[model samples]
Target: MTATTRSNEPGKRSSSGRMIARVVWMSIKLLIIPVLCVAALIVGLAIGYVVLGDKPLSDVFDFNTWKHMYDLVFAEGG
Candidate 1:
């Protein structure tokens, strides 16, 4: 039971090694979800706007298009 033990079993990771791997996986999972969510949102927007809404594909990535949409939803009308 030194720093790391070697098991007779094949491909068995040491306890510390497994803990490190779990921490690394948790870190990646935390970061990956938000990135994947953003990616899914962009893809959904492209499909909805261009395919279903029959708008230009380019508008999906346009800054002004988002600005205009934001304004339409939130601008002061007075």
Candidate 2:
């Protein structure tokens, strides 16, 4: 049997460990999109709640409220 020697390289990582790290990173990257979308939805709902301050909380989800807000923001000035 022959003796094996290991190098003391500073940045050396095992192949399997590197693969596992890559997969974990990819998973986080994939999950971030949906997380961001949900965050945006919550923020939009908060904005709608403020816009419809006197109405019920559930009313923030109403299509009419969104439509009215959209129109107010995008209406052409005459």
RMSD for each of the candidates: 4.4, 6.4
The candidate that wins on TM-score is 1
Per residue, candidate 1 scores C-alpha lDDT tens digits across 1-78 of 569755678787789989999999999989998999999999999999998989999989999999999999998989
Residue pairs in collision within model 2: none
Model 2 per-residue lDDT at 21 = 100
Candidate 2 wrong stretches, greater than 4 Å: 54-78
Clashing pairs in 1: none
Summarize candidate 2's per-residue lDDT along 1-78 as a digit string, tens digits.
999988779799888989999999999999999999999998877776777676677767788988998999999999
What does candidate 2 score on TM? Answer: 0.60
Q: Once model 2 is optimally superposed onto the true structure by TM-score, how far is the C-alpha of residue 62 displaced, in angstroms? A: 15
Best by lDDT: 1
TM-score of each: 0.63, 0.60
